[model samples]
Target: MEFPDGLVADTFARTWEMLLPSGTPGTAGLPARKLALAGPGLPDPGPAADIVLVPTHPQTGKAWQPPSGTAAVVPLSAEVWLHLAFPRDRLLVPATGGLPDGVLRDDPPPLHPAAPFRPDARIFFGTLARLPAVREPWLRTLHDHARHRFPHSFR
Candidate 1:
C-alpha cells in the first residue's frame, strides 16, 4: 500500500516521541538547506539532499551523538549528527547511552545477506539511486510538514 505523506510523517513523529527522553528538548528547527555528508565514504545524494534536524539535550543543553552506522562516520559536531537522524517531533536523546529504538536495524535480505542499516535510510538511498530528482520534493514535503506542525521551532 502506498502511504500518504501525512501518515508517514505522523508515524515517524510518533515513533520518535516514543524513543526520545521524557523531557528532551525539541530540535532547533529544520536545517536551512539539505544536509551534506560529513564523511568521505558515505553515500552521496548530491543535489537530492535530505532535511536534517538538530536536536539538543534539555538539561545539559548538549547535542547527542548520531547512532553509529546510521549514516557515515562524520567528524562534525554532535548537533550535526543529531540533525542527520531527523527526529522532528523531539530530540532523540538516548536514555541509556545506546542507540534509539526503531532507528537502525538489520538489513533486509534484499539489500544485504548479513548487515545492518536503517530501513528508511535504505529507502532513501534506493530512491536516490532510481531518481535523483526525487530528493528535493521528498525533503520539501517533510520540511513543510514540520514547519506547519512546529512553527515556533523554526524561528
Candidate 2:
C-alpha cells in the first residue's frame, strides 16, 4: 500500500521556554561548538555526552525546543534509584525537600543496559516485625524516641 506524500505527524522542541536563565544542576547543555541554523526546525543533536543536552534559545538564553525538527534531547537521569518493593512514586524521598535531589545517588555509567538501582536501604519495620519485639527495657522514652526505635511505618 502507498500513503500520502506528506508528514503524518510532527513535533518540535521548545524546552528552552522552561529553562532557568542560569543553568541549574542536573541540566545538560547543547554543545556551543555546533553550527546551528537559527530557524524553525528540530534542534541538532549535538555531540554525544553522558550529561543532558539542554537546548536553549540562541537570543533568549533560555531552554527551548523547536517543535518540528531538532528532537531536543531530554536525558532521563544519571543517578541510580533504590531497589525495594515499595512503589517508586511512593518513595519520593529526595535528600533535599525538593526534587532532582532526593534519596538518589550519583550513579556511575552502567556497563550493561539496565535501570540503575541500589540495595542500600529497605523497609523492614512491618506489622509483624513491630510486635513489641521479643524483649524491651522497662524504662521510659523521649519525644520521637519510640517512633525512631520502633517506627509505625516503613516510610
Candidate 3:
C-alpha cells in the first residue's frame, strides 16, 4: 500500500517512541525498554523515513543490537503495529466517551513477533486507520496524511 505525502510528513515530523518487551539476559522474564526510532536525515521537511529502532536492553542496560552501517528494517504485522502505535499510558476511549459495546476492559495485549519492525509510512497510517478505537483529530489526521502521502492509493 502507498501512503500519501501528508501522512508521511506528519510521521516524519515527530519522533516515534515505543516501549517494547525484551528477553532479559539471565532471566526468563520479559521487561519493557524504551525505544526511539531513528534514521539518517529523518523527519525531513517533507515526508519519508528510513526507520530503525534504538532500544535499551533492560538486562544489559545498554543499547541492544545496534544497527550496522545501514539500519535494519523489520516487518511487523497489523496487530503488532497497533500495539506499538498507541500510547501505553492512556486507555483508547472513543469520542462517544464510553467503551464500545462488548469491548472488554482488561490488560493490554502482548506484542507477538509477527515479523521484524520496519518504518513504512504507508503501513503505519494504514494500520492506524484500521484500529477500531480511532476517532476525531486522529482520524482526520490519518486521512489527511494518507491523502497527501499517496493520493492515488485512496482513489
Candidate 4:
C-alpha cells in the first residue's frame, strides 16, 4: 500500500482553491469540514453536506481513526453516513485522519471499523452529485480540488 508519493503543485492547488467557488454551482464559500478522529474539543462539521478529508488508506475497520499521511477526500453527510454505518455496511464510511485545523472529522465513530479508506470519487462524489440539498458550489470546489488540484501528475 503506497500513498500519493507525488507532491501536488502548491501554486496549481492554490489556483484551484481560489477558483473553487466559481466552479461549484451555488455557494460562494468552502463547505463545512471536520476532523476524522474523536478527540476532546473536536466539533462535528454539522449534518449538512459536510466533508471529511481523510487518509487515502486507513488503519482499521472503524469509521474514525488517524490518517496515514496521504488524504482521500470523503464528502460525507453526517445524517446519511451515520444511518448507513450504524446498522450495516462498514464500507459506507471511510477512515479519517483527524479533525479540522489540520486534517479532517470524527463522524460515524470508531466502533465499527471499515475496510481502509480509499479515494473513490465515483462512488462518494457521485453520490453527492446526485443529491439536491448538496447543491452548493462548495461541493464543486471539492470536486475541482480532487480533479484539478490533486491530479495524479501534471502530465
Candidate 5:
C-alpha cells in the first residue's frame, strides 16, 4: 500500500498530537522531508546527522511497511528511535526534580520494559542500545538510566 508524503505526515502528526498534552500552546506543523527530492545522503558529522524512524509492531515485533510511492524519509539533526515499548506520552525534562542530569548517565531507569513512561522524559531510548546518530552515546546513556533506575507508567 502506497501512501502520499502528506498522508504519512498527517499520520505522524496525529500520533504526536494524541501523545502531547492538550492545550499545550504550540503552533503545529508536520516535518516530513522527501528523501529522493532532498539532496544526496552525506556522512553525518557531529550534529548534522540524520535520525532513523524504525517502524515496528508492539507485540508482534514486525517492522512496518512504508507506504509506496515517494516515501519521505526526513533526515533529522537529532535521532528518533521508535519502539512499541517506548512511552509516547508526556516527557520528563531536567527540571522535573528528583533526578540530576548525571543520574541519567550511568544506568537505566528501571521501567523500560513498561509503557507510558516518565512525565518529563522527552523520548524513549533503550538501556543497552540507541540509534547510531551524532548524539548516539548520550542517548544511549539516557536510555540506560531509563531501563534501570526510573519508573514506568501506562495510560
Candidate 6:
C-alpha cells in the first residue's frame, strides 16, 4: 500500500478533511454540538485510528461491498469513495453507486469492515500507502475526492 510521494499524500489528507461529510454520518441521536466536525473549524482530525478493516475485490458491476456485522468500515468507505470517484457536481447523489448487498451474518464473511468512521479512514489511508500497486493512484483519487468534499480546507 505504498502511497504517492509526499506531495500527493499531503494533498489527499487535506482533501479528505474537506470533502468528508461533517460529523459522524448517522450519529443523529447525539447533540449536534458534540459532532466532531460540527464546529466552525475542522475538528481536531480526531485521534489516530487503529481499526483494521478487511478488504475485498469489488464486485464485477459494483464498486462497494455490503455492510457486515454490527460494525464494518468498508461499506462506509465505499460510499464515500464512490462519491469521490464519481461526483455529480450538482448537489445530487454522485453518479457512482455503492455496494449492492449488505454484509450478512448468515452469508459468507465480508472481506473488510462494514462501515468505518473517520479515524478508520485515516488509518486505512496510511496502510494503503504500503501497498505498491494502488498506492499513488489511490492517493491521487482520494485527494481529489477530499478536495471535492472540503474546499474550505484547501483555501
Q: Model 5 misses residue 28 by how many Å?
A: 12
What C-alpha lDDT does candidate 5 achieve relative to the native structure? 0.34
Give the runs in model 6 whose Cα sits over 4 Å from its true position.
Answer: 1-116, 119-121, 135-139, 147-155
**Clash total of candidate 2:** 22
lDDT (CA) per prediction = 0.38, 0.29, 0.40, 0.40, 0.34, 0.35
- Report the lDDT of model 3 for residue 48: 32
lDDT string for model 3 (1-155, tens) is: 12223423244323221211111211222222222333232332122323344334345544433234243333333333333443353355655598878989686655444753434556656776786744555345444544565555554
Query: Among these predicted structures, which one has the highest TM-score?
Result: 4
Comparing 3 and 5 by TM-score, which wins?
A: 3
Model 4, 1-155: lDDT tens digits are 11111221211233433445454323456643322322113344233212343222233433443234233335334433443333344443455632447544446554533643344446555665687745566556556566664455323
Ranking by TM-score: 4, 3, 5, 1, 6, 2
Lowest lDDT 10-residue stretch of candidate 4: 1-10
Select the stronger candidate by lDDT from 1 and 2.
Answer: 1
Q: C-alpha displacement of 16 in model 1, angstroms?
A: 4.3
TM-score, structure 1 vs. true:
0.20
By the lDDT metric, which is better: model 2 or model 5?
Answer: 5
State each model's C-alpha RMSD to the native.
18.0, 25.0, 20.0, 16.1, 19.7, 19.8
Per-residue accuracy of model 1 over 1-155 as CA lDDT, tens digit each: 11124423433445333322331323333233333332322444434444322344555655433433343222435443343433253434445675666777354322212532223534433444575443565434443444454455434
lDDT (10s digit) by residue, model 5, range 50-113: 3224344455655443333233244322212222213343355445566765666355443442
Root mean square deviation (Cα) for candidate 5: 19.7
Worst 10-residue lDDT window for candidate 6 reads: 31-40
Q: Provide the lowest-lDDT 10-residue window in model 5.
A: 35-44
Tell me the tens digit of each residue's lDDT in model 6 across 111-140.
443543234445555555565643355344
